[model samples]
Target: MTLPIEPTAAQQAAARVRDAVHSATVGLIEREQLAELIVLAAVAQEHLLILGPPGTAKSAVVRRVASALGGRYFEYLLGRFTEPSELFGPVDLRRLREGVVETDVSGMLPEAEVAFLDEVFLGSTAILNTLLGVLNERRFRRGHTQIECPLRVCVGAANALPDDESLAAFADRFLLHLFVEPVPDHQLEALLEGGWQSERAPLAHRTELSDIDELSRRVPLVDLTHARGLLADAIRKLRGAGLSLSDRRIVKVQRLIAAATVLAGRDTATDADLWPLFYVMPTREAQASAQDVLRDSMSAAANPTLRAAVEHAVLQPVSRAARLVEAARSCLQAGADAPGTATIAEALLREIDANFDAKSLPPELAAERARLIERVATPT
Candidate 1:
């Protein structure tokens, strides 16, 4: 008989934190990508940027994840007229009288473990420099003094990418740049039903700071040699396609890939771990090309059968939609007078919708699914 293996301490901790954080933000519709990035960035001790318009639950997602991690949270919305004192804290008047210059550094970004800056690129030049140092070096420095920061990850949200070349450096500080959009039409009802629930109830289970600290320490220890060759090839392809990835960013990304491996309870990083690279493009225009390169890379590295299965599901959605419709109709007919018939039909509709998003199906399939749902929903 084969023996069963137990999970390592690091694996257990990673799973615990992942579950806690995911459960805390479950109310946000179609936010699986955002949640995964949040956990990955936190475990890697790197920053993230969410690019989307206002009211996309960008701030809510970060705030909820931070709350579940039981960390000191700081959030600010920057505007053209914003001042450094608003984000960094005010200077100490008493200290100035004694011939010293110091910001209080209390209850501000400098002291926060998880910080969210909405409209992050709107800060003035002075605040921009200070913010960059805090993000890149994890240290806050002022005239003649510097202090270490406890920031695990800083989440920034912006309506659009910065147009000025001067802000490129600041933009590069966040290793992961995820694009979030409003929920699709099909998910709107779920969004309305559950979105407010997350705001009202706090997460029951909390992940202590020590758990994240331990995970960070173990992330770099995971082996990356297995995927090194594939990663190099992907990097070449990205650069050949007009994307610029700095050496520092490349090194940082290794840590993120290793962190993802650890989260999967593996000691060796695999080609699949490179999926996060899709979001690291330096420019918005480069995202589609980068995605294509990364997807092709992943497909090349994946098993042939698995790749074909994914392609079939995504490319041949008509067959799958027909199957789902048939299933729903059968259930409704069998349980015509049963109380659970409507519930079953609703569940099938949700599955169809989820699969639609997963496969990026055509509008025709979506229309068919809607018609099927309506037929099943109408009383006999």
Candidate 2:
């Protein structure tokens, strides 16, 4: 038998990112997509905008992911009356005394490597205008205060997409748009149980900003030769379905594809990385349509690190099996050794049976199903 090969540094780093992602997601319910998206956008060096009603765990997920990565994080809620000073910083009165104007950006959005802004569309024109510079060029400029922003990824959240035509251009700057709904009826029991428990602790994993930078640096080095043709075909299919992306978006999707390659610990990209293109669809309706339109093209899509994302994007059985395996493991470990475990275990068993035919279920999920079934049948 051949000896096992050692993992490359890039692959090791990718694994760290994966662990950080799942660690953040451990106790959260139905928010796996957001946790995974945070890493995807961060690795791509792109921004993400999430549309969901309040009481969904959007802020909690972003905060935990940022903490896992160990960086300067800034979070703010923007409103019509919100001032640029609130996010950027107050101007320097000391500089004004010397007949100069500048903003003290210490501990503000510009210096933050990871940021989350709620109600992002309600910002005043000044805030948006100033923010455009940070998101686009990573540069902040004001009267006399100008510095390069260290932002790796920024997430914006709102109850819904903006209806104002004028705000559309600003919104379009964000490359990834995800619309999230509250936990489903079946998962409500788990959601309630998770929230009611006290003494929740944050993830202990330590992933530095440098690891993220390394992954992003690899994006430019990834060979996209084999994947380009399939990506082109996917674009054509999206247009054929009457769901269109801007020429700019068409070009920048390469960043996401390349980033996915880096996250997958590969130096070359392929059809397996193409699932990212689906998340770029501007609207939920367009995304639903393109899911069918580009299904055949991206049937090979898979990512070990982002199993939940791949499953959510492509809806493939293989990815679904991987995601379910993860959920099963979490349920077994995080659940208290108290009563009512069998109820939760039974729900998980039903989900596994619903998704896969008994004969076709992958061995990993099959084993998980067995364990869950045992847990359900055993008396507490």
Candidate 3:
């Protein structure tokens, strides 16, 4: 397919960039799951919760990642013995005399852009409460002032998912849940051979916040029409399978796709970028739920009849809209000599977009939807 603009070196460099990032982070874990963890952490622009026993290289991996991406780093261990003041900051004494609590935002959660909170569930109420706002709203309020922490990602290291009710809300805020284990027996020799620690300098991959902001800017512009159906179908199937994840995850997955596309310097998302799900899939029990969801989806469904119904219900309108866009481009490029130039192009685009709106499938793909309706209804 021809594009209006030639694919530049940035576009050509996607795989190289991805591979470098992948290789840089791979040795820290025993399996590819950790790689997926890093990808999700990057794309979702969300924190990751690593659940495993100690000595799994959780901090090492996160530290290597921060070094590679070049984001600010803060690491702290949370335990019954942990202190809130250590993780956040010390309150200002002079301000306290003036009936004000002034705290310098310079520690683990506040000053760092990408953070590593070890033993996250063991924190006291103060830290957990502060974390709730940091993870959810991306802001930390102290005294009468709110601190907007420029967090690219936060990595929480836990021995396992917390069972306590008080911590569950904070735990749930982590969008990606990954199980990290010690290196395999075979890989241990290599681990020993390579030395016990990762050689990655924290600043090596430290991407400027502006670069991330630019990636955010580019992602929403990416067209994901082709993959949208598959993603939606996956979500519906996961729901049907009784996965315990919340609806908020659907939004997170969408954002992950967009970010992945941007990092690839692409204008649209596709199945190639779907691998990031390995990180974001909910629980160990739900890995099957995720696999089941994608098994048929990424493979192309066996139910051709149902697939056709889906295509007719979803793909046809997008196809028409794409054609309309192509036609509009041609008309506009004809230098005004083309017949009905502006009006014709506008009318076609408007109709296609109008049809695009009218073309969404029914939520319940019941018997009625299985049989194509004469006209497609617009997506709300």
Candidate 4:
């Protein structure tokens, strides 16, 4: 049987790409949220730093992401002794025979479309130092020549934070940092008994690299007025929790806004799309810091849930009338005659009056209901 194709937003190319990624993978904990963040980072063409203890399936997820896109895969386990040669291709002895300064063979760093650096912070000063150039500049200098890489995204897993001062630069290069801890005690027994291990899966559908590039170009155009206020609240909460806000990271946070915008396929980003920024922050302190922010933004007072009676009897008609007017305008755009302006305006006003009358209740009850409706209508 053929799988049904899902309806997608007009500009959200990443949504389709994400579906392809979803079809190829299995066994990611909280797969829905993970998939969304993965697609957002891919859409933004930015790297992520996966922080977890061993066996958290970080590498497996990376493999799945690459499989979905049919990109070149390069994996490395960095250690204290790992040299720059392990990443950049070795010098060609044959090139020396011709007195050539550069070797034509490409290194893993240069040729990789998607790279997974496991135990990333374990590398020597040279390797960690070199990654700074590769990630930020997208180039690796070999002798007198520089090689440009066609890197789509890089996913690096860290067992623990590194102590080396130079490695800090490499750590900062990843725009998104997601920490994956083991499941809670309630889920641990099931996970162990479930016989899950990271394994390769054949691709079910593949995404074109061009689709990813197109998503990057389109994501920035999404507007985010409502989301910006909530995001500002969230960031304020983080600051209140005593997390240091770096000036450089403020710019990075804005970049993820573009990612959120593209994911929703809107010309403007909304509160619904800003949900993932809660997960993309760089530090553990920042992640722990957003709890108050979420509590305040998503609370009953801020975003109350409306009663079914009110929603159906009052809100529905008003919403329907607004949509009907929009549809009439769209019909006019299509060169089809619909209702006249005066008629449509009167119908809308009538609907509004009916809605307000139906929705009216005791003053206190009405206030509570409005609060509840506000919570439900507030974006994610």
Candidate 5:
């Protein structure tokens, strides 16, 4: 567990996360947001809850991340009848014979570095109560079966959030919530292509578990003196707009902000890193409304490793502009004469113009706009 020097550690950790996420997303079309957040949660030592329908590839995304990052992966589909032992493992008969109870955690959720639990809310009360300790304290405690869990991130996926009031506390333990939907019709052709590629190709990179551990250790040491005021102001605006913010969430969100800074290759967090505060809200509806409320404080929010995540969090011109520039650049680089290049460049130009005012466009965005315009006007 040798930690690198200050800024160098940030740079190395950022590169590791970026490469792993990039590899995980290679054949998965439009799922980069999920991949990026998976790495973020691992680095921050928190949990993620994904709200998407049955066929949305939630488990696939988590599995890809685990594969690219080279860790032990465990996945299960939970049901009302799923026994605690089904996930935790069976009790040791030898220990039971001695009038002691303990779980044999070999190849179980407690031993997994990365895990996914589908239909998480359907788990019985006994299961959810036990699962909470793993999420909150990173420990497994049941009778005499106490063990430290090495789990980096536990992703819980449900088709929809539960309507039961009693489940709310358990669900809230998953601090970050992401809502996903079926791919829209326009991307169906790309979806077909990506699906075929995914079946044929393996992930492109491998990262060590120590990379994640080093980043987690760095999260607490990140300089937040300047970013704190920005975050506080954003919270005030969200509250004024009628979004509830519990004191616990307000305190814990600092970890997410610091993790973002480290993953963005910076030692000190700035106003740009405050965008993760949007995720502290407990529900999808609250998150959607938060985008508009916190727009001013987050105009500078951008992350090269997490561009897709930034797009999902903030839909402002600057954020939208980043994605447009990436699209335009990719189209330009694939030989401006490549098939469908003009069509892609045309779409990017139109999107750029629609999202940004030419008279007041940010300089970097304005340059990308010019590049797109030139590519559209002349095919080669």
Candidate 6:
């Protein structure tokens, strides 16, 4: 009998970090995507931006993830009138007496290893300008003094994307732009039933700062050559689809892909590693287009079985429509003049048409969507 092989130290460490992040995210409804991206962003040592409406649990998710990592956490809510001192700490009185302009930089964002800033787009020019260095270079500079920041990752939450051109550069600082939406109707019951139990429970598994540092060190060692050609093709497709990626973002995103590969216990990046690119688009429309481009590219690169699986998943929305169509047919047969029957059928048809427009569905699925819409609209 062959002896069982034990996981290497790196694998064990990565597993521990993954488990800790996962544990923190437990009991969150419709937040798996955001939680996963948060963990990956931390592993990449990059910043993230969460875009969604109020009460979407954006702040809660960031807090739990930061807590799981066992780091000094700082959180702030920014408004249009927010001042730099509010987030970076006030200036020292001793320095003021000497006529030196320097922030205290104690127990503030600059000193924290993990930070969450809500309504991040509302920051004024002064506040945002001061933050650029800390977010990008992990260095805080005030006056003539510059201090290294211990920030591992900074997560920003906003209800909407910045409309001002001035905030564009600041927005681009966050590599991952994840959208958080309310839980689906099916999950609402579970969400209400669970209430605050999940939020109040203490995290059982914890990842120290050292574990993350080790993972960051390992990311660069992962071979990116395997995915380089695929990445290049996908980038070209994205640009052709009218979503331009800056040179700076292009270079930085490579590190994130490699980080994901390392976390998965692989030495080489794969097509699935490009999953994060789906969220990197600047706008919601561009994000949808990028998803189509990525899905097609990943499907082409995958083996026959994997391609079939991807195709199946991509067609799931249409499948749900088909089920709806069947249900409508039954309702019509059972009660031709039933109240709300026609209304429900029309609603389903509209949803099917909307799905077809939103996604780059395959030819077969597109044809099916059209047929379903026609059938639902026509009597009998």
| TM per candidate | 0.80, 0.95, 0.69, 0.69, 0.87, 0.78
Task: Write the residue-wise lDDT of candidate 1 on 195-309 in tens digits.
Answer: 6555666575677877788878888788889788888998999888778789988878888777777776677888756665666666666766776656656652321101221
- Total backbone clashes of candidate 3, pairs 3 or more residues apart or in separate chains: 14
Candidate 6 lDDT over residue span 1-380, tens digit each: 99999976667767787667656755564564566676677778899898889998888877887888788999999988888899998988899899987789889999999899999988888889888989989999988568999998889989888778888778998998877678766455446543355756678688787877877888888888978887888899988877898988887888877877767666788886665566567677777677676666655222110122122223334334443344345334434354334444454455455655645554554554455466556674
User: Tens digits of per-residue lDDT for model 5 on 269-344?
Assistant: 9988998888778888899899888877888898877888888898766676676677667667756765555655
Task: Tell me, by TM-score, which candidate is best.
Answer: 2
Which residue pairs overlap in candidate 4's backbone? 222-267, 222-268, 222-269, 223-267, 223-268, 223-269, 303-375, 304-372, 304-375, 305-372
By lDDT, the best candidate is 2
lDDT accuracy of residue 221 in candidate 6: 88
Q: Relative to the true structure, how large is the alpha-carbon lDDT of every model?
A: 0.73, 0.87, 0.57, 0.58, 0.83, 0.71
Q: Between candidates 5 and 6, which one is better according to lDDT?
A: 5
- Cα displacement (angstroms), candidate 2, residue 235, comes to 0.6
- Number of the candidate with higher TM-score, 4 or 6: 6
Error of 5 at 334 (Å): 7.2
Candidate 5 lDDT for residue 219: 94
Clashes of each: 0, 0, 14, 10, 0, 0
Better of 4 and 6 by lDDT: 6
* lDDT-better candidate, 1 vs 6: 1
Q: What is the lDDT of residue 283 in candidate 4?
A: 68
Clash pairs (backbone) in predicted model 2: none
153-235 per-residue lDDT for model 3 (tens digits): 88887877767776776777887777756765544444553333345322223334444455555666778897687677677
